[model samples]
Target chain A: ARPRVGYYFTGKTGSQVLTDKIKKLQVKDFQSIPVVVAENVSVYDAIVTMFLEDVGTLFVVDQGSILVGVLSRKDLLRTSIGKQELSTIPVNIIMTRMPNITMCEREDSLIDVAQKLIEKQIDALPVVKLTEKGIEVIGRITKTNMTKALVSLAIDGLV
Target chain B: ARPRVGYYFTGKTGSQVLTDKIKKLQVKDFQSIPVVVAENVSVYDAIVTMFLEDVGTLFVVDQGSILVGVLSRKDLLRTSIGKQELSTIPVNIIMTRMPNITMCEREDSLIDVAQKLIEKQIDALPVVKLTEKGIEVIGRITKTNMTKALVSLAIDGLV
Candidate 1:
């Protein structure tokens, strides 16, 4: 018998979000800001931008601004040392492209979110919501916030 | 006000543990397995392990078997050429040690896991879990698995 989709479909709610579960815990939370860059960014400028931002990565986006690939410090450094100089290289030239990016729906459970992280070998996921046009990027999730919550929850969910 | 802890605690399921979460997905699932080695293992052996395992990096574990460091495939090979001879050297001689290691708990949300992988400038995660004895080692998460899972899930979930 086919399993019912209704059984698996979850309601997007605060209680379902792992953050809310851990919100009361007194600890650092993972911020939602994800550094983004244009897909055609020159390698030289991208590296400078990353350094300026003090972040190790940038999200390459389309003109519509949805995430298309990930440009890491290492990726930029590697491409820079190669024959192609910054001007000749596009962000897409060495970027870790998608659908290689791990992503989640706003409705996903923190447990489900964590599972995806471990299973995906990724450090960040772009949270999105379903819309008539397509999957729309919305927020980000971090491991630190999840950990603080998890520790509290593991202690019998003590607040 | 404190919420009720009784209903909040997620109990042990026994099977499909946090370790299982790390191992269940292959790179084919777009996840990466963090490869590892013993502290006493020669850099030569570490190289061989890297090739055989097809992993780009490895973790170094201590006498009690707790993870102590990370060694990229490139770092191991580059440092091994003149830094230490396999005949008398140990991975600990050159491996980047912990708490330098970018690690995550079994319960961390995937969003954070992905961020750590990207931010840490490394390719894998050693999922750890607390046991009655102490914090014990679990399976690895890798970049290959992360990408593979991304490709697979993108197709499976979206298309």
Candidate 2:
């Protein structure tokens, strides 16, 4: 028979308790609905979509909504300021391509997501899941969402 | 005579060293050029400006560049999605008011700025200075900047 181990109490206090709670929390607990756009969309339209969606970062997907790349406000802003025509430019040109993007699974710990955000120097991560077709973006985890989680935990005195 | 205290090391290692470095860093050390827009500018124009400047947040200023309010991409996105006309809506109406805006001085510690970014549930903070004319917008400190600093420290093995 396998030995059963009960939960252990380490007597965590102060910020340590907060860290523990964050580590215990998963990305699915606070992920928000993702705002995505087609990879071939014009930068101008993408900007409008971003405004309409109330999101700073927009995931660029294919016709089937499969994750392809990611675009941020900075990318669009940089393109707009350039001499190139915004309406003629496609978002795929400036987006961070796949294999270079950092994403988190639903089961990823919030602390790991936060660390990735810092290490990767990005504002948000696309929450994704692996399917037979490949990776599909289901939601997004952002600094704002993490902050809300922290605030809630603080309010509840759990951290 | 005041007693002189000698510097002491607690023998921090690895991540602890990084934490100590981050805690000792100040906002001024990593602040970036601030993007500002006139309060009377239309939401459409503000979005364009944000794109042109490649910034997620824009500090709303008056004729003298005095700090008045703050606007984020989310604000513009929310407003653009609303029923109101985007071209006619002024940013001042949607911006976070001065009293409610959280700002940091140039001398503030980076750790404190990071904490405020979490506690207030905001991404960027305007780095301001108290002058005879009033508060002047000097720069901006953001999560991206903080992450860059952390990454650099990690790369240098200083943290």
Candidate 3:
């Protein structure tokens, strides 16, 4: 029965309430600003941008500013050890290209994104927005964001 | 007054129960196996080991099997871009040495470690054990683990 005068028993357990609160969390509420680079940029420049921005992941976009691929520190490290020159190699040749990219939207549930990260064993996910032109990279959601979410949940009653 | 039957009110709110459960989570419950490299190992070899082990962070230990330094993917990536040959440079030269390494114990609260990871802006932490010889790396806790913790918390009632 519905509560009357705010004094009725709700019958919901503590776990149920916690689950409700966690489920309500959206990617937009905890996502960080994204850092991107052009697809034509050299792998060397991409690494430099990664260092300057201090991000583990970088989204690769085309000249029209549409997300085309993704780059990770692991990908760069592997290519650096090879015989090819870092400056001569374009990031598009080595980047994880589209259709293989894992992405989420601002309105997606944080838990669903968290599960994708774990299942895919990836470091970060691009929070994207679909457009008439193409998909646009709007935000970034990494394990760091998930960790922050856990901390906030414990520190506060609701996230 | 306490109820004589099984209907006594505990007077704890849902958030209180959630907080208590989250606070009780320990590092040992979610940590992954630690990956370590010898201090004398070449940076190139260390990167190879990292890829083989498939971990973002690697602990560097001395001849006595004591934790001496920590190597991150960022460290190796930065060195890879330098003029120096990665095969010739010892990891100890590029690794973050002792007294600066952020670590946690097995019994430590997961929430506390999560805070350290965010505060230090690092990728992972070694779960250590103090012996007469030195600190032994027993486990590893990363943002991935924190993400897993969050997922578990939502999937199950308590984690």
Overall lDDT per candidate, in order of appearance: 0.56, 0.75, 0.93
- Looking at candidate 1, what TM-score does chain B attain? 0.69
Please identify which of the two predictions, 1 or 2, would achieve the higher lDDT against the true structure: 2
Residue A30 miss distance in model 3 (angstroms): 0.5
Q: What stretches of model 1 exceed 4 Å from their correct place? A: A1-31, A44-57, A72-87, A96-100, A130-136, A143-145, A154-159, B1-159
Ranking by lDDT: 3, 2, 1
For residue B19, model 3's alpha carbon misses the true position, in angstroms, by 1.3
Q: After superposing candidate 2, which stretches have Cα over 4 Å from the reference?
A: A1-16, B1-122, B127-132, B136-159
Q: Candidate 1 or 2, higher TM-score?
A: 2
Q: Top TM-score: which candidate number?
A: 3
As for DockQ, the candidate ahead, 1 or 2, is 2
lDDT for predicted candidate 2 compared with the true structure: 0.75
Separate DockQ for every predicted complex:
0.07, 0.11, 0.85
Q: What stretches of model 3 exceed 4 Å from their correct place?
A: A1-7, B1-7
Categorize the docking of model 3: high
Best by lDDT: 3
| Candidates ranked, most accurate by DockQ first | 3, 2, 1
lDDT by residue for model 1 (B1-159), tens: 545643322343312232233333332223344566788988767777866775556778776767777787546534533424465777888888766766666555554565566666565777776666644557676554443333232233211
Q: Model 3, B22-136: lDDT tens per residue?
A: 9999999999999999999999999999999999999999888789999999999999999999899999999999799999999999999999999999989999999999899
- Measured over the true interface residues after superposition, the C-alpha RMSD of each candidate is 10.6, 8.6, 0.9
